[model samples]
Target: MNLLDENNRHPTAITDNSAYDGEPTWSPDGRWLAFASNRTGSGEIYITPLEGGVARQITHHPAWDENPSWSPDRDNPRIAFVSSRDGHFAVYVIDLAFVPGAGLPAERRVSPLEYTAFDPSWSADGRTLIFAASLRGHSEIYAIDIDAAPSADGYAMRPLTDGLIDRQQPAWWP
Candidate 1:
């Protein structure tokens, strides 16, 4: 998983030996690279260096952890991703600065604690995130303001699409 520079020099293997790997994201500072791999017998997110080195696992579970989106804030280095640890697929987030790896601290499930959510895309403002979820048994798009503290009931998720053809992939306009 070695990444090349602009000059196509300084090649290195990001992962020593991994069966699957994809969705690599560089930190805002461009110091580290985060990606998903199934090397531990189950798909999990891991972070490595663009300069080449052993990767660090960021999620641990029998379920799959895929599609990592790094926060634009470099100090915190938060990562947003999807996971199936709760039987149903949902989105989650973790702070790389405080949580060194998958085992540093428990991963935070940022999606609706009760609803199924997946494929999260960050908003340009970095205070919001867009993801796909089911409401009233109908799949649609949703947006949440992470900056606002979630009520005890749970975080707020507003539907963006009506009950009709599924809106597969969603991205906020630049």
Candidate 2:
């Protein structure tokens, strides 16, 4: 991926690898970037310092994990991403504050198992996540309260738009 200035000039390569890396999201502090890369063969979440260095793999899964969205809260540097590890696309959140190899930080599945959720964006307060999902034969936007405890099936989710037209990518305003 390339980073460009406000004028869309002087684009600099953020990830100049040949690993099909895309969907980059900047952290709240703008010091780091979180993106999805297939460098390890399967798509996994990776974080790299904006200054430059080796990118660290966050999610080491065989299934595709893409569309990473960093929380807006600087204190809670958590990442919300889409993963297909459960045989279906779902939204998951991981705490970046936790050490990488520390017994695998608790991964919370924010979306339910029945739906295909993707392109997650965090609320301004970082307490909710908004994403697009296939529901009732059409794509729609849904919001879930991640701060609340999820039930056995998943977290409490609500649709934001009617299932009239397809809505793929959702961007939450600050």
Tens-digit lDDT track of model 1 for 1-174: 666655868765666674888888878778788899998889899987765567888788899889998877755568889998988788898766674443473468877746778778887657788888864565688888776788676876677888677665678787
Per-candidate alpha-carbon RMSD to the true structure: 2.8, 2.3
The lDDT for every candidate, in the order shown, is 0.78, 0.87
The CA lDDT at 136 in model 2 is: 65
Distance from true location, Cα of 17 in model 2, Å: 2.2
Point out where model 1 deviates above 4 Å. 2-12, 100-106, 136-138
Candidate 1 global lDDT: 0.78
Best by lDDT: 2
Residue 162, candidate 2: how far off, in angstroms? 3.0
Q: Give the TM-score of candidate 2.
A: 0.88
TM-score (all chains, Cα) for each model: 0.84, 0.88
Give the distance in Å from residue 88's predicted Cα in candidate 2 to where it truly belongs. Answer: 1.3
Candidate 2, pairs of clashing residues: none
